[model samples]
Target: MLGVPKDEKPTWISRLAAQPAVHRAIRTFRLQELTSAALKVRPIKRRLPKSGIEYRVRYLESFLMADEIFQRKIYREAFEGLDVRSFVDLGSNVGYFPLFAVELTGRRDLVGIAVDGNRSMTDETRWHVDHNHLANVKPLWGIVGYPSDVKEATFYLNPSNVSCSAQPVLNPDVPSKGRIKEVTVPTVDVASAWMQHAGDVRVDVLKIDVEGFEREVLRTCGALLDKTSSVVVEWHKWIASQDEVEALLRDRGFVRFRTISEDPYCGVAVYRPRAS
Candidate 1:
């Protein structure tokens, strides 16, 4: 309840539990089971036969993300026939997206830059890249969506590792078991950093999921959008609406062609240059 917004309405389940002592007891029992499950979670080693890659995921969220990327095929179109020689993930958690790119493209030579604001998560990403022998994938510990002049920024690390975000006020509601932690991380400007990492090659696929700081990310994207071929962004409407995000991309000559998934809290959309 700490992170719940003041104006937010109670969820149906919350309302249901408030009706009777029996309902409240049921809710309490369910919550206890959920907490027990969370406590028992341990590192899991999973191998994707198609990709021929073994993932070392520590958290339940990481496994769920694996399901999203590998099973759901949310970004399938982004890699279908794009000849993705290079890609960048703005909020790479444990490097699943880039791994999926490698799997989807079947290109071991593919170059990827995975960036994360949380040091622990970034380290996990690096472990995945190293252990899996993804020679071309580089894991960076930094924050994106800020001006190049800005060297470092404050980042909030949520208990759900994948929910780590740059915007302080955009923190997601967490279980009462854990509190949000703040840390300063180095900032990256995609334009300059991309060139430095993978040379001047146009970005084959650009995946952005910086929690709710997407507007800032797009603002600093500058001319880099022109050099990008495909963009798959997960937009948080609570901080910046889908329309606002799409408008920013439209201004840079992009058109939203697909809405992979959507909900009240967030949505994932794919974009491509209008001329293409």
Candidate 2:
């Protein structure tokens, strides 16, 4: 994979872009407002600065996500000092985090698997992988759950948003007209699915953002949890409190390093194996 451009703008530019004041100003000033409004009818390709990778996205959700992953450096701390050769992404929306990982690691042979329950989101993720010639990253479409939970599951799709969930009531916007679409998707175990792609190789990093199904998704990892070096998770407060999230990981022999971000809806934290 090609590296960040030498002539790319300074890191401060990205820091500035990540600031809340600047983000609000950009929206308030109608900088992206007009463009975003126009793009609602059709999606467009936007490149991440420095990485030379372009992602195909339609709504403001993706724009905000791009800024969070690339500009805000949301997962940077989780990735630092780790030898990331293989990664697994659960509930990958447009697959920005996997792409960011590849760039941050600067590893040409890194392998990534991005899994999403939404077929459209999977297609979008595939486009990014193919367009950027990221052959090592594989996008799989399926609902990740415990191995014995169900063979097929109902996935509540949020057409206007990427944060779909198995729990119908999880999306607050679902009460509105035509906002939610119910679809049955095949379910796969996380460890089993990953083993099919990378065999028995240890996962360097595992990222989870599965709406309100974080605990169920984590259950599917099974023994692979022992083989993973670090985990970055965005836990929904309604499904599990921050302490509950920590307790779940603790039972699996992982300890929380620190939280990256926290809001009413969800919080992101990094975890590593407990020291002997």
Candidate 3:
């Protein structure tokens, strides 16, 4: 309820619950459990305007649904004409960003590698790719950070949200932390993952949404930095400060940067390599 929008309309179940006839019919049919189960899913399929591309996603289970719905125009503006031939989505829950890239660029042949630490999420992403007959989406299941196999490394799984992370503290002030479970997942360095997944291919767009562990993910990408033209990162003040993130990118030669969101703590930033 906290993250849900103010003007969000009632779900179908809420509407049905309001009607006595609907309840009576369900009780008569003895399908209350089935009906209840079906009503819980929110927006199973999303169709991009003018692209004729439809993606089936678990919208309610992840935070990405809001982005896919409300932030459609923003993504179009940020990546529409970026010439993204090879794209990598870190923390790709159900693979919406990759689909956006393919649809926006109008290049179905573009290479997309979706990386997520959660096995179920990776499986779901693979299913989406297979369901759409997409040969370009490479879904990889592994923790995204440098110095793999650390002793204390653990991923905190959010019960309601699919976008879980290694860092547990979302915000002390924010009551809804969303973390429900913890699991030890195999880790992969960002630089190695880029080379192994995208190899020899210049990644035109690199999108990372690794919850709070962004610094670790960005620290080891020096090898992949030159190949990447546009970098989009969701920075969280709860995990790492914004100044550290900006300075890291600037030191790597991405001098041109712009803030996408007004919230410094929960902000999105776009960076491009400095002109030589």
Candidate 4:
């Protein structure tokens, strides 16, 4: 449906203008921070980038939180300039990037599968897909991680953020990484979920952003990787070293296309590999 804009709109300013001052005052502490946070977690309705279809969007909570830590646009740019007709989004947070990438493929026949451990986030993803008249996107909620036979595990729900991860968190300054309460969620084997939701379609883009569970998830995804054309991953060094991550990609015939500094502890990698 679309690609990056030739002249991107100054979204930060508009996001602030759209929010009433009373709401911002009640939830937010400063105006500059609100504008800065307008970059990634968009919860507003705008035309779906290039789809020419008006969508009902759910931007991140505009109240009680000032910003989003995850930069969704970086993933958008990573998926660009590819032949991605279909995609799989792991750790799908309210289906932001998958929906964006669905528009990016500019293909009406594409299949989009969004997976998340959080039920609420999955519901939101499903709602966005259905309400936007997009029959291509599907949202699946279950626990998925590095372990193959993980029957069940504790899922940390960050009440304050959309990206509540699977790992135990400490810092409160990082949005969802803090204020977590553990709850048991049903686990789904990655391969099983892939077979069930993805069916037989070739997935062009396989994205993994499972907080700190990237290693095991990637380790078991060799066969899926063999069929995938590209990958977008947020590899955190705290969970696994960068050297280890790079080596894993190298062994799998995935050449890193772009690397964006996400933080001191984490980095986003976009990869292109041989079409098997």
Clashing residue pair totals per candidate (backbone < 3 A): 0, 0, 0, 6
- Give me the candidate number with maximum TM-score: 1
- lDDT minimum window of 10 residues, candidate 2: 1-10
lDDT of 4 by residue, 32-86 (tens): 3454257336555556557654443344342211122122244665666767778
lDDT per model, in order?
Answer: 0.74, 0.73, 0.65, 0.63
lDDT score for candidate 4 against the true structure: 0.63
| Top-down lDDT ranking | 1, 2, 3, 4
Winning candidate number (lDDT): 1
Please tell me which model should have the higher TM-score, number 1 or number 4. 1
Model 3 residue 122 lDDT score: 85
Candidate 4's C-alpha runs over 4 A off are 1-43, 53-72, 171-178, 274-276
TM-score of each: 0.83, 0.82, 0.77, 0.74
Residue pairs in collision within model 3: none
Across residues 1-276, which tens digit of lDDT does each residue of candidate 1 receive? 111123345444333422445324534566433643664475567777787877765654554466566665567877655778899888887788877887787777788788889997788889888988889888889998887889999999866566678976642332222457898889977788788888878898999988888999998896678899999888887688989999999999999867776655677878999987
> How much is 72 displaced in model 4, in angstroms?
7.9
- Model 1 sits at a Cα RMSD from the real structure of 6.7
True lDDT of residue 192, candidate 1: 84
Residues 1-276 of candidate 3: C-alpha lDDT, one tens digit per residue: 112122345444334433547535644564533443463465356666756667764534333353533343344435634667888788887677776776677777778688888777788778767766668668888777766445235878764344478777654443342336888877766666667766788888788788787887788677777788888887777788878888888888986455555343466767888883
lDDT of 2 by residue, 1-276 (tens): 011122333345444533457645654665554565777578777776666777766655676677667765678778877878999888888778777886788764678789898997888788878888888889999888757557899999864345587766563322322357899998877787778888999898888888888887776675778888899888877677778778878989999886776644567888999872
Note the residue pairs that clash in candidate 2.
none
